[model samples]
Target: MTDVIIVGAGPVGLLLAGDLAQTGVDVTLLERRDGAISNLSRAFGVHARSLEQLDARGLADPLLPTGSAVGRLRLFQTVEVDLGALPSRFPYLLITPQYNVERLLLERARAAGVAIVHNAEVNGVDQDADGVTVHTTGGSHRAAYVVGTDGHRSAVRQALGLPFPGRSVLKSIMLADVKVAEEPAELLAVNGVGDAFAFMAPFGDGYYRIFAWDRDNPVPDDQPLELDELRQVVTRALGSDYGMHDPRWLSRFHSDERQAPEYRVGRVFLAGDAAHVHSPAGGQGMNTGLQDAANLSWKLAAVLRGAPDALLDTYQAERHPVGRSVLRSSGAIIRAAMIESAVGQALRGFAVRRALSVPKIRARITGQLSGIGYTYPAHRGEHALVGTRAADVALAGGERLYEALRDRRFVLIGDADLPGWEDRVRVAAPAEAGGPLILVRPDGYVGWAGRDGTGLPEALTRLAGAPSAHMAGHTAS
Candidate 1:
């Protein structure tokens, strides 16, 4: 039996597999598709948080070449919002197609000795106290744990009888990736046209991905998209009759705001679109999914490697709230973009302009855009700083908290006097920049941060590290 079997070879699934394999877990990833497709631009924006997660695995540099950095994102009839204003080491969004992101992750997973079974669609799954048995079209495989990163129509979720509770937005949107002869503009634009809206983003390849919606039209079936329909939508929205041709791909999709009742069901877990699917209004879907994988990967690794089982429970505790927040935020974005009434449009336009003018309001919006506002609740008796994401603080090692965390271990940073802890925790003392003893989790979150090491023992215990066996449970420095 494998340690973990991840269904779906999307970016999130591949990212989880890569992390697990890098940490010496025997993982198998099953993808229904035979190979990756490059033409489809399912998702176009990778937020800063996902970039941070990718950097932790040393995969960002290699994948950086496939996309460009986008610092400004514009809303309909509003000023461009600067992504750099977002508080993150990666202060910009990476504009890479979702397929390319998946491809790079898959390559990293393979290099880490992960086994991949393409075209192996999972039909059913059975989980007990021992493990999970996954039945795929190719064959049956057993795993200590199984993660479903499949899309909204997840077969694993269906088999487990999980309730996917939500309703559709009832709006049909169309997307097309085509070569545009128009010159590159300073800012990509999303224009609101009375009842419809259109967004145009340049891919830096003399091509652009355009998304347009028809508020009155019903959802289209497998009917092939016509070039005239695309051109007409662009003309109506942009008020320009530019030369539009050379269509690479066209697709129609509807938005659903559904979310699973629980992300975890015993040994089987749901992630990405399987756990929650919502309108891609703010381009938060893929970013949320990547974060889910990042959160779950380390916890699974720790549990398999003899950490406390409680670590696994934190997966749902942390990510379920995150998913709910995304659903609500995206729903608001959709409402703002699709309001057909003239009064509603005027109000939304005014609000957008007013929000941009205020620094605090702008920063709050940028935080949502950059995905930096996420933080888990501190566990009981843990340090106030524990269970929070470590800010990028300068250290004596001439590195930052995020840079030091690249080692993917709980890091204890302090002065010469260090707490007595096991070797699983790494200690670093700086010649300069005196700070409190800080314990960082493997996933780059702060497990403990205090001046006198007030909660180091409890933090270490919560992080699955063995504290001193001789000393009783007490704060130590």
Candidate 2:
């Protein structure tokens, strides 16, 4: 039996697979689709925190060069507001198509020795105390753990009897990637109608991704989409019949802001759209999924490497609230952009403009959009900062905590000598640099940090399985 079996070879699944493989776990990823589709542009932005996660896997440099860095996001209405004051190292959104993101992730997963079985749909799954037995089109496979990263209609989630509770927004959105002769100069633009909106983003490939919604017109799932119908909607929203030639792809999607009741059930877990689905208003879907993988991957690794099974509980604790927060923010964005009543539009427009005027409010919203406002709660008996992600701080070892964590190992920072723990951990002195000595996890999160090393031994014991007999001798200088 494999250590883990991940359903869906999307970005989140591939990311988890890569992380697990890097940590020496035997992982298998199943995908319904054979290979990457060229015209898929479902998601087009990766936020700052996702970039850091990608960097951890040594995949960011090659992947980033394939997309554009969009620093300014312009929200269009009767009045336009620019989001430029966000406080993040990646202060802007990176505009790469979802397909490219998946491509890069697949490459990294392969390099990490993750076995991917494509066109292998998971039909059902049965989990017990020992392991999970996954039934797929090809055959049945057993795994110690199973993660569902499939899209909205997740087979794994359905088989597990998880509740996807949320309401559909009752609007039909038409998305098309087309080569246009006369494209707008703005990197991103959202034109507002009475209760509807149309957004366009130039992908630098002589193609533009156009999304237009018809307020009060919700198409049923089985309904057919006509190209002429989408063209008319585009013409009405743009106020001009701009030619859309050589259409690469066209799709109609209805927004459903649904989320699973629980992220984990028995040996089965869910992440990405399988766990939550929201309106693609702020391009938060992919970023949220990537963060979910980042959070769960290390925990899974820890469990496989002999940490307490209780570590698995933290995944839901950390990510459930995050999913809820995304739901609230994305719902607001959808309402503001698609609410039909003139008064509602005017009110939302006023509110957005007024909110943007406040620096703190703007920064908060921007930080949320960039996925920089997330921090997990620390364990009670551990250091006050043990479970929290280490902030980027310069170390005496001539590297930032985040930079040092790229190797996917645990690091201990203190003034004390940790000679006995040197084989399993890296010790760095914080006083020699401008910041505190911090213990960093391979996932680029801070595991512990303190000046006095009050709870250092206990924290290390918990994270590293058990403490050595020499732990008592590694006292602070």
Candidate 3:
């Protein structure tokens, strides 16, 4: 039996597996596909928050060369969110293929000794008080906990008898990755006219990803898609296809907004598309899933090491609400883009421009889009910074906050020492004097902060398992 069994080896699963492995957790990744990572990518945009998560793992700098960054993201040609204003080291979206991310995480997982079982299709899961038994096409495996990072039709979720609750948002959406004869003026172009919509983004290579939708022509997923149809739809919706041609890939699928009623069912957990999915309008789908993995990984690691079991429940409390928020925001964007009448389209453009002109409204929109502004729920009377994302503050060693977090240990930046928690926590002084005492979580969120060290021990108990001498975990300086 392993400590954790992760079903699916997509970016979400790979990241979770790598994280668990890094902290000395025995992680087994069960992938249905053969022992090969696909080059194709369904997600092309990596938001700023995801880049921060990668930064914590020391992968962000290495990933920069693999993709390009765009400071501005245009939506429907009428609305745009300038990512330059985001308060992050990675203030803009990275336009890399999803495979690039998976490749990096997979390497980390392997280096950390995560056991990967290829061609293992998990068909059932049986969890009791002790552990979870996952039944796969190859065989059955046991683990203390199970995580399903599978796509929308998650077998683990299905075995749990969980219902994905939501409705279809769009139909006959055509996807194509090809080389465009004419480049768009902006980094990204998306617009709708009348009953059709088309969005295009570069893959950093010669190829580009396109999504063209026809409101009147609904078709089945198996329906044959032609390059001519894709070109014509783009031309109708975008005024010009930018001379799109030489299709490298082409397909058609509908978009849906779905959220599982339960993110956790007993010892099994669902994340990524398994927990929630939504309209592709905002490009938030992959970003939200990566965030889910980041939140759950640390919690599971702590719980496995004897932290309070109730801590796991916070996964749902924190991420489920975020999932619902993404759905609402993405749904609103897609609905506005699908405005059928000319007057409605004009109003949508004008309203979005007007709303974004206001500072508060613009901040909220960009924050939601970039994912850097999200924070977990802080307890009553807790410090204001408790649940907020930890900024990359400078430390005495000429290192940054995220640089310290790369050790997979909590960095306590303040005037206190974690006596019995040296192995799992680190004490560092901020480069600047008079800084507030704060404990930054491994995932780069503030776990605890106070004027003094009065509640430090209690917080450590909650942060990691009861601190023991020289625990089996990584420690920063």
Candidate 4:
């Protein structure tokens, strides 16, 4: 028996396993594949907020070298959003392959002692009042909680009898990762003419990932794609092929927008693609899933360490709404890109231009797209600062807020006389004086804030788990 059984060793599961194991929870990660990461780069754009989460874990700086950062992201067909003004250390999008992320997270999880079982495809899950049991091809493993990060066809979600209710949005989308001889004028290139739409972006490595669609020619996903045919579609959409050749990966895929009714079912939880899926328009699919893992991992660790069971309920309360929002936003992007008529195209560019002209609307759109504008729901009469994203602030002794959060402990950002919560809460004074005493969650959000340390002990106890007695070995000194 373990404290947690996490199905799927993809990026989401790897991140969750790493966090739980870091917090001293006994975690087991199950993977369907034989532990080899494919070279395909499906989800490449990591937004600012996700970078902040990675920054808090001390992984952000290390990941910078593996990918390129782009300040401007073109969603589809000339509509682009500028990510420059987003208030984050990582104000730009990091264009790295999903496998690079998984590799880093998997290494961290293993180093933190997470027991990973490769080729242990989960077939069934049973959860009762006491705990949950996951039956796999290898054997049965029981745990206090189980999370399914196993993508769209989640065995755990199916076993729990949950409904993933959504419809197919786009069909016959051509996807490939190849080399482009000539770099496009824009950092990211996307254009749509009539029905033919093509999108391309750098891997930051030698290869480039391109998504092209020949709307007039609809075929089955299994239909073999010829390089010449793709080049013609690209030329139709953007007027130049940019010397595209040497394909490493190519396929035809359909995009579906799906969201599970409930992210949690008893002791079994669902996250990532297992819980929701969206069109690949804004590159929000993988970013949203990574955030889901971040939001839930801390809560699960808190619950396992004797926090109230109610805390687990917040995973659904907070993340389900975000999932729905991504569906709408990404769907809008795709639908706009697929506009068939010239009049429709004119209206799309006009509406998008006008909407983006308003400062308030522009900020909101940028925030949503970059994941910087999201906030959790706060309790009634709570401080306005509560549940807002906490940007990295300078702490005493030349450290930053995210650096303090690297320990996975609540950062009490003001003087506090808490005796028993030493292991779970890290007290730091702001580098400058007279700042509010803000309690930052390990996930980089403000849990509580006040002029002084009033209501902080209760906040720490409730959010970071009841006071632990020892200097826990799991924490990094």
Q: Please, what are the lDDT tens digits per residue for candidate 4 over residues 1-477?
A: 899999998889998999999989999999989989876758887888888888888788888898888897664455667788888888898888888888888889999999989999888998888999999999999999999999999999999999999998767889998898899987768777768888887877788888998888989899988888899999998889999999988899888999999999999999999999989877898899989999999999898888888989989988999999999998888788888888989888888978888889989998999898998899998789998989899999999999999888889888776776777788898898787888888888899998765576567667876666642322211
lDDT of 3 by residue, 372-399 (tens): 8888998998999998989988999799
What is the TM-score (0 to 1) of candidate 2?
0.92
lDDT of 1 by residue, 133-235 (tens): 9999999999999999988999889989999999988455788877765643543556665667777766657677887877766666456677788778777
True-structure lDDT of candidate 2: 0.78
Q: Rate the local accuracy (lDDT) of all candidates.
A: 0.78, 0.78, 0.88, 0.86
In candidate 3, how many Å is residue 269 off?
0.7
Put the candidates in lDDT order, highest first. 3, 4, 1, 2
Q: Name the regions of candidate 3 deviating beyond 4 angstroms.
A: 470-477
Candidate 2 minimal-lDDT segment of 10 residues = 80-89
Indicate whether candidate 3 or candidate 4 has the larger lDDT: 3
For model 3, the local distance difference test gives 0.88
lDDT of model 2, residue 353: 80
lDDT comparison, 1 vs 4, better candidate: 4
Q: What TM-score does candidate 1 get on C-alpha atoms?
A: 0.92
Q: Each candidate: how many clashes?
A: 0, 3, 0, 0
Error of 3 at 75 (Å): 2.2
